[model samples]
Target: MRNTPDQEKELDESPLTDGSDELYERLSLKVDKGQEPLRIDKFLVQRIENASRNKIQKALEAGMVLVNNKQVQPNYKIRPLDEIVMYSDKEAHGEEIIPEELPLNIEYEDDDVMIINKPPGLVVHPASGNYSGTLINGVAWYLLQKNKELSEQDLPRWGLVHRIDKNTSGLMVLAKTEKAVRSLAKQFFDHTVKRQYMALVWGDLVEDSGTIVAHVGRHQRFRKLFDAYPEGDHGKEAITHYKVLERFGYVTLVQCVLETGRTHQIRVHMQHIGHPLFNDDTYGGDKIVKGTVFSKYRQFVDNCFAVCPRHALHAKTIGFVHPATGKDMLFESELPADMREVIAKWRNYIANRLA
Candidate 1:
């Protein structure tokens, strides 16, 4: 159970009048001798309505619970005649939380596997920055709504086989059952899943096509970034095959195929080369250059950065074998509006400049 700060203050003020007055609420419970000594948090979870185990643990860690007028450890045992006091300052409000019925863009669905076209900015799971309204939550709600017509177990359950970054929009596959999950996970372990990406970088590539073979690890100075080291102590072998698609003055469009999937592989590899993705905040592509009268292309470059917030990259395609049916499946997503707009504007700028 949880109460807002304002609600708690109002409840406390309404019950008290004099400045020296004390307000207290007592709760009495009989301890069962047969039951083993349980942790304070575990015990509180059973007593508190609408309170989760995590919430109870936080309360215990914050010293909000007391046993027999004395603060006790989480593992302390409760004896007969022991009084438990929880100073919540106000009564907890209980509200039923129902999952929101949200629409899902499912590309393919089968007994064993499911493919989804994940949009940019939709987080795959719940994390620090995002709590509710996630792709996982939406999937669960979708399954629940489907279960009304079919059996509860018949609905397609998304056991995450692999994950894509929040900002990287593309095809993602999920498993429906435990057997399918194991089979698909084994395929990923065996390097059978083929992944590809398309990126627009800031500079032209000297070579039309090339392979970036490097040992990728966390950067020593900047923990957030990855670096390629010659010595290769703690990094993993990463291979990226890139081919030139089109050229626009100093900028180039390229398609990247991955032999191994690492965190931020495309972004890091692009930065390792002379050409980094435009508007990439992490690997030094943040400045917006407005084209002057002499350099008429500067405004187009600035507008490209203004339209796209993050790196100019997208997970274009993914192909893998279906775990349940042992059939081949391939999925793809087109460039999002932001990336498409950036490319269209850049193409127009280059055409005008050459003309």
Candidate 2:
């Protein structure tokens, strides 16, 4: 319920700043000194009062269960003196939202839903170390300006149906009413919502179109970052279909369609195939991953990075059924200036190289 376009039951609910997912500790316990070796899921069910096995399994699969500060599978055997921690994605409700007079690019709004073209570097919701200056605070202010009464209890997650990463620029839909919340949530949960993203990757894609099937989960070493488990041995299933839109010699522009909207799905999937997003520092695309080894080439890439400081990704298109009208609604946005400028530089660089 925290944030996502999919119905994934895990602690990684929403995309946060730096593409990290915020997790809240729900339970912590240490195994007995002489405890028998049992599956962690079973151990939790037996020890935790009023907790069901199903819930424990869900947490384990979601990487919410950590043993000795490490993520483990549900079948992991509990050892003596094992420190276990469980986390939940549920946000603390009733937190007072401070309304801010931030500018909002409201594309479409009505009694049911409000479509916003969120700019880059704007956080969708407030999290730790970011109590204000977020899109949700602006939304609160906008609603209050219209003289609409807001109750945190009634409007969960600040009426945010889903979210993209803070550094990723894109279109987002917010629920304006309780009915819209339930309806849009159902659409996302059912995976009926359509989302497309534009990304500039480091390498030239050989295939015109392809599908990437992997399990996306938090990286074992870098807990804040995510990785793709191509073997499907870890994490939840994620699928991304990408088509090559344009090809520069060193980089390529691609359009990604999400089949399952896991956190950092497109980023992880593209990185898994050795084509990390251009300038995406978290996924290891900040440095030059392609191009010649000449210093001039290095300087060129550095200039491009300066032009587009963040990851070169944009939520260019989103389509979903109108909650109240019961009609299909589609919205599209052009690439931001930074991304456009960077692409233009690449075009010039490639043309000169060919000449």
Candidate 3:
């Protein structure tokens, strides 16, 4: 779980700070003496227990496999004494998702998959403090109601392919069958899946379109929050491309496209550049990062915070190839009501200020 916000909380069960689905692993191995040249995927498959060749190859396609610190294809041959580094992303689960009768905003569903429009303040899955009333619990109950009853072993993590933070409302795809889970996992692993989010940051961007490339990892001091390393030395690689959509002087609305899913990629990247998401308490967006220190202005900002008491981020669109049909699937979601109301307030306030 991540520190999104209260009321309009941002919560995701992903291992990455971005709240995107996937737990990344870094592995390094030296080729032994008299080692025969083998394809990198095959090499990883043989060396890493419980990892399949298909999964390893998927990691390669996603540019997670590297030779001498450079991305390599699955077919790349491993040479002796060559330093090999690999990054692999996979789903993490603790136990079965217990079925609970809770409200779920299911967008689309079929035999193979289900598309969900997750609402803010909803935990995606059960964790230590939140063992019930999660999206996974609701999903489990929904699936059981529609499909045949099955043993606990039949399901894994409620077939979730990835996650968004709890306070960040957005679209998520869930697999229905074992094959769907494996196929969807491959898509995410390969970085072929497309994810876009809409966010309101506390400052105006200098450029209408720009990219934020940084290394994001857990904060050394505040373990709950993430810190961005713009130098790109430590932490996972994260790239976020943004285009300004609307600007409200003190805040700007932008659309963010993710090339790599790292924990808190958007929030941390924005904050690193000095524009944290509005009302993102964990990242200090809750304070007056932008605008004047005047009492009147401060009061206005406080009013805005009360209107939308959470980080201003929404997963607006997600696109991927269907696991079973091999067809392109894209889903879009409208901004939630709370976000809409807050943006409206900003618009009105700006207009009045100009007048």
Per-residue accuracy of model 2 over 207-239 as CA lDDT, tens digit each: 999999988888888887888998987677788
| TM-scores for every predicted model | 0.67, 0.75, 0.78
Candidate 1 Cα lDDT to native: 0.65
Query: lDDT, candidate 3, residue 146?
Result: 74
Can you tell me which runs of candidate 1 are displaced by over 4 Å? Answer: 1-100, 148-158, 288-296
Candidate 2, position 205, lDDT: 91
Whole-model Cα lDDT of every candidate shown, in order: 0.65, 0.80, 0.79
What is candidate 3's TM-score against the reference? 0.78
lDDT for model 3 comes to 0.79
The TM-score that candidate 2 achieves is 0.75
The alpha-carbon lDDT assigned to residue 121 of candidate 3 equals 90
RMSD of each: 16.0, 10.9, 9.2
Best by lDDT: 2
Q: Tell me the tens digit of each residue's lDDT in model 1 across 284-342.
A: 76554222434445665667778887788888888987765677878888888998998
Please give the ranking of all candidate structures by TM-score, highest first, separated by commas. 3, 2, 1
**Model 3: residue 20 alpha-carbon error in angstroms:** 5.9
Each model's backbone clash number: 3, 0, 13
